[model samples]
Structure formats: structure tokens, C-alpha cells
Target: MSIRKRLSPEESRTAALEAARALLIETGPQSVTLKAVAGRIGRTHANLLHHFGSASGLQKALAKDLASSICAKIADAVIASRSGIGTPRDVVDLTFDAFDKEGAGALASWMLLSGNEDALDPIVDAIHDLVVELNEFGSEHLRDSTLALTLMALGDALLGGPLSASLELPRTAARDRAEAMLLGSIDQAGTLAPEG
Candidate 1:
């Protein structure tokens, strides 16, 4: 039998969350269970329970982890776009991918349907904090743009493929629309600025 390397509490928790995230992306949120995570990490269910208390708690921690990392990346993309090193499409793609490929949308819906509504607090709080942080970048319409972008991303994650196919549009139609919205917001912000 192979010996499992010891990990600190923080390291064990992080490893569990990372494994859960991978499982979420690979299978779906429904597979992100304490037993599965523990198995993946070579730990016991009791260990996961020690860290997270329950499956709901584990899911909440995973939500918080995803939100924090996604927001940081998006914030970097937004700042890079402002500095001409990135584009609005980068920000839009990141947002959409977080909801879609990263499985936040599916996980959020699962948590809600499972009646663990409070688990969404981390996601909501992260978005709010991200918006507040982005405001420092000085787009007057940042709040409205963030609101629109988030809803659009979430909706697209849920239905963009089938809906686009039904409408005879490309799968990326929603992403294109989101990019356009960001570009329009940037133009509008520029136009409304007072002359220096």
C-alpha cells in the first residue's frame, strides 16, 4: 500500500477544493460530494467532514474558492484591457467561461435546487466585491455593465448552446453580444467624460 503524504489543514482543504472543482468541471456539480472529494484526495469522509462539516459546507467553500479566483482573473483582464494589453472580449470570455466551462453556473443552480440557498452567499459577495473593486477603474457605467454582463454570462452558460442552435445562430452568439456590450460601454464612458 502507498503511504499518503501528510498535509496541513489549509493544504488539505485546498486540495479537496481543487479536486472538487475538477470533478465539477469534468462531470457536473452533482458529483462534487464529500466522499468523492475525499477519495480523490486520498483522504477519508471523516477528514472532509472535519474540514467542511457537510456536503453543503464543502460546496460553499468551493463556491467561495471559484469566485475568488475567477474574480481575480477577470479583474486582471479588465485592468489589462484598460492598459491596451487586453480587449473587452477577454473580459467577456473570462466571465462566460467562469460560468460555463468552470461550472459555476451549474453548481449554483444545483445548490439552489437542493435548497442550500445560503451557499450562494459566497458567489454573490464575491461579485459585489469585484464590482466594488472594478469601480476604482473609473467607468461610470461599471455597475450597470457588471450587472448586465453577469446575467448574460449566467444565462448563456445555462442555455446559450441550444438557444443559439434553435435561433440558427452561432454557439458564441451570446459571447459576441457581451463583447459588443462591453465595447459600447467603453465608448459611452469615453464620450461622456469632461475634457481635461
Candidate 2:
């Protein structure tokens, strides 16, 4: 029999994480058993445990990986929103697009349902940065604007398609209204930022 090539600890961990991430996006967190991930990565479950210390460790690492990817997209959206290059509608559309395209909405739902609340920290931190940007831009009520925009975009990602089909509304009509309202609020607050 031929000897198998050895994988370094880092390579093994990365391979396992990539497998877990793909599985998470495809079947949700519920399906990410160590055995499944190990099989997907062509490693033994013990090998994974050796690297991760335990199944919980693997899940935690996977959650962190997923959150980081999702958070980066959100951060980019917030960066765009801060720039003032795009209108409010543009910001809203980009936010929803980022969530939907990444399947982040579903991934988040699964991770939270799986009792991995730690998964949300990175995304929360990213949003915090966005709020700070809005505050610096002269938003009178940073809390309200952040809450409204975030909830609106997330709702749109989760329900926009089905709602659009049921109402016979254009897929983007609701988003358009929400964006207009978001812009209206910002306008009412006034654009004191340099970009304006």
C-alpha cells in the first residue's frame, strides 16, 4: 500500500473549515456533524478533534468563519453607504443584495437557531462601525436610523421575493419604498457630511 501525504495542522484546519462552510451554506448548521465534515474533507473525525479539540470547537470555528465572511460584505455595504456616492436606494439595494447573494440571511437564522449566538458578534461589530459612520455624518438619532435600515434590509432579504410574488408587486418595489423612507429620514436630518 502507498503512504498518504501528511497535512499540516493549518492545512487540515482550513480544509475542514472550508468543508464546514460549504455544508453550512448548503444544508444549514444542523447538518455539520464532525463525521460529515471529516468525510467531506477526507480526514478522520479524530483528526478533526485533534485539531479543533472538540466538536464544539469545530462549530465555533465554523461559526466564526461564516460570520467573518458575512460581516465583511456588510462592512462593505456600510462603507458604500458612508461614502455618499450611492443614493439611499443604492445603499439599501446593495445591502440586501449582499445578504441574499451570500445566503447570509439563512445562514444566520440557522446559526442562531442552533444556539450559536457567538456567531453574531462579528456582524454586530461591523454594524457598530456603520452606526459610528452615520453618527459622524450628523445623523441625529443614530440608533433609529441603524435599526430601521438594518431591519428593513434583513426583512427584504428574508421575505422580499415571496412578498413580491404574492402581491404581484415588482420584486424591488418594497425595497424602493424602504429606501425612499430611509433617504427621507436622512434628508430630514440633513446632510452635514463633507460628501454632500
Candidate 3:
């Protein structure tokens, strides 16, 4: 006797999102299509439409999931950065690592929403909420400074600028250089405290 195969609605939704993510990473968002997602998951286009309504719906869901996942990592890294058990250099390093995972997703999602003002507003608002929550624990001055550095580094790396490659230097070397620069600035500003 031949066996029948079936997937629950939730399972199908999950599988579709997984396929969408794979496609996004493999060929960028331009290649994402409901037909492709369904085919990749051994389902029909009609079945995909039934679950997600439209290609855009699936893409939206994928973007939301990606944002949530990336934010979780950022939260973890931010906690480590706050402990003072590690230096600011360590914070910068972890921020870069977090961007490496979520940067592309955020960029793509923003680009998509930008062309659709209705979607753009809500997504940006959500991101702003996340950012506010994530940095609330740190001093406003330090939080702002850290966010500025993270954004600058992220932009530089994404743009492939000459100095951007420095972000990929050996971890120890990068940390030492960053720490030296940070401490040097503090000393120059007369903000450095004497050894306790």
C-alpha cells in the first residue's frame, strides 16, 4: 500500500518561510516568489496562496521573523557589552558580529518597505521600538555612542570601503587597536580616571 503524506497548516507555513529564507540568502530577495517557495517545499502555488495570501505576505512574514531573530542576538550582545566585565572594544566586536547576521536582512526589508510607504512606517516604528528597548539599560551617552559606532561600522562594511576591511582584522588585534584609540581619546579629553 502507498503511504499518504500530509503537513499541518503551521508546518507548511514554517516550511514556506524556511524556503523563503534559503532563497533570500542564495539569490537575494529579487528571486523570491510564491511559486518558487511552493515548488521548493513540494507544494503548489495555490497552496502557498492559501497560506500566505500573496507573495508579499510571505516576504513580509519572513522579514518579521528575520528581524526578531536578529534582535534576539543583538539583545544578548548588548547585555555582554553592559557588564563592564568586557571593554568597549569587545562591545564593538560583538556588534559587528550581530550586524553580519542581521544587516542584510534589515537592508533588504527596509528597501522593500521604502517603496511602500504603508509598510515602511510600521516596520520602522517597530525597529525603533526594539532599538529603544535594547539600549535603555545603558547610559544615554554611552548607548548613543555605541549605536553610532555600530551603524558606521555596518555601513562601512556593507559599502566595501577600503577602511571597512579593518573590521575583519584578527579579533585580538582589532580589540587592542580599538581599545587604544578609545582610551587615547578619553585621556586626551581629560576624562580618563587615574588608576584606582
Using TM-score as the measure, which candidate wins? 1
- State candidate 3's TM-score: 0.63
The Cα local distance difference test for each model comes to 0.94, 0.70, 0.60
TM-scores, all models, native as reference? 0.95, 0.70, 0.63
C-alpha RMSD for every candidate: 1.4, 3.8, 5.9
Q: Say which prediction, candidate 2 or candidate 3, comes out ahead on TM-score.
A: 2
Instruction: Arrange candidates, best TM-score first.
Output: 1, 2, 3
Relative to the unseen true structure, what is the C-alpha lDDT of residue 171 in candidate 2, on a scale of 0 to 100? 92
The digit string of per-residue lDDT tens for model 3 on 1-196 reads 8443699999999999889878877776766789999889888999999998877777777766665665555556556555645455655565554444434434454556546334333334444655677544333544445446555545543553344355675534434454565455434433433334
lDDT of 2 by residue, 1-196 (tens): 8565699989999999999878866786666778999999888989998988866577767656654665465556555675865456666766676456545566566667777767566556667765674466555555576677667767777798998899999998767877777777766666553664
Q: Rank the candidates by lDDT, best first.
A: 1, 2, 3
Candidate 1: stretches off by over 4 Å: 137-140, 194-196
Better of 1 and 2 by lDDT: 1
Q: What is the lDDT of residue 173 in candidate 2?
A: 79
The local lDDT score (0 to 100) that residue 161 gets in candidate 2 is 90
